[model samples]
Target: MSISSAAPPKPTQVLPYATKDLHEVYTLGTKLGQGQFATTYLCTHNTTGETYACKSIPKNKLLFKEDYDCVWREIRIMQHLSELPKIVKFHDAYEDSFFVHLVMELCEGGELFDRIVQKGYYSEQEAVKLVKNIVEAVQDCHSLGVMHRDLKPENLVFDTVEDDADLKIVDFGLSVFYKPGEIFSDVVGSPYYVAPEVLNKHYGPEADLWSVGVISYIILSGVPPFWADTEKGIFAQISHGILDFQSEPWPVISDSAKDLIRKMLDRNPGKRFTAHQVLSHPWIVDDNIAPNKPLGV
Candidate 1:
């Protein structure tokens, strides 16, 4: 359906919309996923028969009151990048008296982490392809001045379960748009993947690259580069930027791959490679090169 038929969508929250209007335009289906403040459902347009992922956020949640603007920002960011490759599509945001609805592209495959675990073992070539798609998605967002503060395995999904399906980056709840040279102050993102600057509450886009580096380490090694028995321990390890390559997988992985991860996980934000640089790095762009003999994955 031409979203033109319904009331024009707003980038931010509007007054409670009519429940009837929602039912009139789209047929809601099964529950697809859940979050801290909302649940996503499968839905189809009444006229267009187009399928979409609808995130439903309850108005009564305390989180809604605190991060109301963040929700709107997430919607707007998705809207801005809807047409960009490797980024999840955003169709619309609808609100009623009780809840807000976010319609977006449906990612059918499971999380990248889950897929890797299921596959049991993955090659360096496979990791390279996955990282390329992920970097391109982040690069697109960075080009638009948007920072996906939270980029983890849970947020990366494939279009389908097919072997060659394209990967997509999703979830922009912690994202924020900023001007060049401006420093972001909010401390956000999962502890393990967060950049050192974020821990100090002073950071920028490079902070996100650090997260990609964390993810790169996990995908390639079949395990996280940093870990501890407790949350405090994990954060401490992250702060120190200590990673061990003595494990079985580490010894077998190619030197170039390890080099790229090190560059991305650099303690100094100034030295960390940006998304563009990561995409062009020798490890990521070189196809003929083979990975380590025993891909711990």
Candidate 2:
């Protein structure tokens, strides 16, 4: 007797957060952005007529169990921080055989980095305000037990095109829920913003503050503190942790600002300032300092 051999059928991937049919609720429109795993679109509610940004991830892209888990974790993290004013609000999620749709608040003002760059020259007062919002968001995330592994200018956006628009944090794809003192070994984060300890393959929430410091440095100086042509070189410089405050803008930059950056960017994660500490620092809290002088680009 001859027996035929065949492989067993794979289990179906299911997304718990996605229940409703996406097409039934919202009309997916123009493409906003595209990433490796998902494509974001301008979507409008069919009934309410409200507009939103919908990130649609195709099922085929989830080639592994870890990919699906990452998607689920992102949805959970967004929902966990939904109430935060600085975080992009997660409205709903939907799933079908083909895709998983995530509906979120629409940020029409483009990226925070773009807005700052367009302004050409901004004062320390302006930079302080922007950094304050970012640090406050970080503090909130930490307090809620979420670590945003990726924190960079591109991830920060303005809710509207208006001058007074609120800066909202977006893209929690790399974030994870962590307990106090829990160490993560994964080297996950943008090259320029990533902390040295992250490169060392061991880090905690303090890594976020290091990114914040890199952002602070960029906002004040219009350039990244660590610079190199290649990713490897960049990582090397970040590992070295030497900050350049001798550049054109740094000479005029306030001492208080530099002090805060020094504290936040400390090579030793233990010595790095917590989000709360950065928020409470005199440079961040006191309005009297952080001069209003325009930092020339």
Candidate 3:
């Protein structure tokens, strides 16, 4: 299958609470994010006053006949891996002809993409810490047979607290549940982060790891390695397994960081390091490792 040009309207959407009694569990607020298929909002539960993120997608998006089946697929996968910690917490999902509301845990501080934009890129030590936490989270997802088809800096949200900030992975709209020996053929994910096999229409969990590699490269280099002049060129580059690391304006990165990228970006899925393997790599295990040290701190 070739890459599709059709894009969604927004990244997320927010819907009004229609329950009869105005309970605390359904106080809707401002829009958090909007996608082509759905929208998310920050809401406050009536009784507890606790806030949550509600992703409301049209009911039609799930009933087939919709432009993309991704929204429904995401709901299924999220429901399956709802118990994982780092994965976005699923609160409730309901549909009423007009819309489907997926209530999930609220994470403040926005996405890691915002932080990256603010700080440019991260230091090696900082990158390692963040990658470590993310690896642990992905490991959790893999353990539960979930593979996040889209794993980018923007999908990582920060749960900001006073002293301890937690990294939570969100945006499961492209995720899928997998069993051993299953072969996924969907050519999905951001062009910049997609694995080579995905471009060839043969993908699996390793595709997710390829995205991780892109995020890791961004964490260290402050830019993507496989950038192209056009959409077609981007897919072509990804398909041909050409990574532009030597392109100028590079940062002062370590060999370990580069090595990690090389391993994760390997064109052959069989050769790409598993998330667990990446976690155990020497770069993540060196004596300098620190659990909570902020990236580039």
Q: Which candidate wins on TM-score?
A: 2
Question: Across residues 22-46, which tens digit of lDDT does each residue of candidate 3 receive?
Answer: 2335888999999877888888888
For residues 215-280, could you state the per-residue lDDT of candidate 1 as single tens digits?
Answer: 998887767888888878888888884688778778778888889999999988999999988988
**Candidate 1 Cα outliers beyond 4 Å, as residue runs:** 1-20, 62-66, 292-294
Off by over 4 Å in 2: 1-11
Q: Judged by lDDT, which candidate is best?
A: 2
The C-alpha TM-scores of every prediction are: 0.90, 0.94, 0.83
> Model 2 reaches what TM-score against the true structure?
0.94
lDDT of each: 0.83, 0.91, 0.75
Q: For candidate 2, lDDT tens digit of each residue in 1-297?
A: 998886444334647543878898899999999987789999999999999999999988877677788988999999999999999999988889989888999999999889997878899999999999999989989999999999999899999999888888899999999999999999999999999999999999999999999999999988899989999999999988478889788898899999999999999999889988998999989999988878884
Alpha carbon deviation, residue 3, candidate 1 (Å) = 47
In angstroms, the error of model 2 at 40 is 0.9
Q: What lDDT score is found at residue 195 in candidate 2?
A: 93
